[model samples]
Target: MRRTLTAALSIAMVVALSGCTLVSTLAAGDTPTDTPTPEITGSGDSTTDPSPPDDGGSDVDGSGDDGAGDGPPAIPSDVPLALGEAGEIEGRGGNPVGTFQVDGVTTGFDDCVEPEEGLSYVQVDLTITAEDDLAAEEGSLDYATSFALFLLYVKGPNGEYLGDWLGHECVPSSEWIDDVGPGESATGSVWMSVQTPVDEGLIEWRYGHQNFVVPFP
Candidate 1:
């Protein structure tokens, strides 16, 4: 129980520290009945934000509509992201968010606030790069995606999940040091911890209306 609450609190701190815009769902017009999200709200700055479709937020797939896609707009649906592979998405500000990769997941960080007992806090080494969209194909990704925040969760073998605007289960500690400008790249540490009891499971990046899974032990 300590691990669970501690993990939730730890990630909650990250959400507070990072300049993340609190969103109900990370994607477009749709819902994940099983996902738990954070209660913290964003700074109310939707400008250039890759927010949910319900917020009058524009789609990130370069489609003018509100991301009313059958699958995720950025990547094809159900395509799991492998370690070191980059998943790209365009922001609303005409800036493309690229080099979005999950480097690695680590636990038992010495600097973590959790007590060294039961399950320990997990950390995901992440990279979110902001790219220049000036050269983008005409009318392509006009909203040019920028790095806002990526919601995360851990999926059990049975398909159960946790974290974010709902409750902290496998939330990422992705508070950036500064705003990632075009042509600039930044690596943020994402934290995760499972409350229902398993650490070694599939980690999913809840991007907009789609989930890009990461195979992890």
Candidate 2:
């Protein structure tokens, strides 16, 4: 009996030792992993592409934009000019000559010249044509044309004259009409300062038909 009991105890000790060994082996085999393994397997080569870098640059040329250095070319418009009469008349000096004339007015010139010690200003009377008569010929004073006066320059005894005449530049519009009231006339003036020898006499304006020699002074 004693021998049998001892053998049974020894066997139990061996079984416990074996069980501990098995548990230790399982623990050793199990390891904590950072990345989870994918279940779906891909056959073809798998690759990860890196992100691209950022660049702050522009692709704007002169043709692409405006308002900066890229602006459109400038263009001029067709402007019309007018003078009072067509023949020579008594102007500043000894009844000069009148070259400018209105289309309809029968009178010689609707203009006057005033000489003031090397300075001169002319108050020239003009007629505006009616809308219906705007088409009248150049020589006819229809008195109702939608027109504006653009005086480029004038003729002086000394030479070509440019003045505050710029003030006479007409507003751009065919729709604007200058109406003539019956016998009453429309009037405008051109102012000028003498540049050349005021005594050159017989001052024919580059534009107007009238030539003024002025009261020889």
Candidate 3:
């Protein structure tokens, strides 16, 4: 009876160990997953999808985002070029009150000059007229009062284009007019000294997209 009970207990222990080994092998081979598990995080699960890129290859307006196409792009009109008009001086125009003709001619600007042997320089002359309401209202702001002329140029008469000369040079700036009154004419000259090979036509004049000699009007 003792030998038979011992044999029965040994059989039971073997069966229990075999069952545990089968369970571990199955768990290693077959994992439970309702969603994809990539190495990276933030990826969408089974139900959601990733977003599309901004620019579609063909540039067609309605390619991806929805049936509604992109709105029409803005188109700008060409304004007539006036005789002396610089078109716009930025910052100074658009004042509420004034007969402002940002229009003006650069009479002449000298090639790099030297007042003294050690002092080499260049100067630009311009004539501007502001009649009507703008002239009257210009006095209210002290900083907004001056008419600025920027001179764009090239180097050594042969080098690539160097930009505007008003503030780009070494010499002190010359102010033509600080403030103009109503029904009055404003005239002035500004000058600067820069280091470069000096020659005529080296400094190119620009008014909007147009390029030419000074004193256009």
Instruction: Identify the candidate with maximal lDDT.
Output: 1
lDDT of every predicted structure (CA atoms): 0.55, 0.35, 0.43
What digit string (tens of lDDT, one per residue) describes model 1 on residues 1-217?
9999999999998987663433433444476588987786888866777755576554566677553544335642554778778876534332344556778865444444443344446566677775576234243332323443445665665556643222343443445223455677887665555444455666666433345677765
Worst 10 residues of 1 by lDDT: 134-143
Model 2 lDDT per residue over 1-217, tens place: 9999999999999999999998997889876567797797787644754765455344355454435643222222222233333332221222332223333211121222333344333322333322222233243221222223443233443544523232332323232224333222344333334333333222232212222222111
> After aligning candidate 1 to the native by TM-score, how far in Å is the CA of 151 from where it should be?
1.4
Tell me how candidate 2 scores on lDDT.
0.35
- How big is the RMSD of model 3? 11.9
Clashes of each: 21, 40, 6
In model 3, which runs have C-alpha deviations exceeding 4 angstroms?
1-46, 51-116, 131-145, 149-184, 202-217
The best-first sequence of candidates by lDDT reads 1, 3, 2
Relative to the unseen true structure, what is the Cα RMSD of model 2?
16.1
Q: For every model shown, what is its TM-score relative to the native structure?
A: 0.46, 0.23, 0.33
Candidate number with the higher lDDT (2 or 3):
3
- Candidate 3 structure quality by residue, lDDT tens digits, 1-217: 9999999999999999999999998988976677777686665564544765576454465456663534322222223334344333222333432222323333234443334333334444444544454443334232134333443343333434533444444333354443444445565545544454244424343322223333223
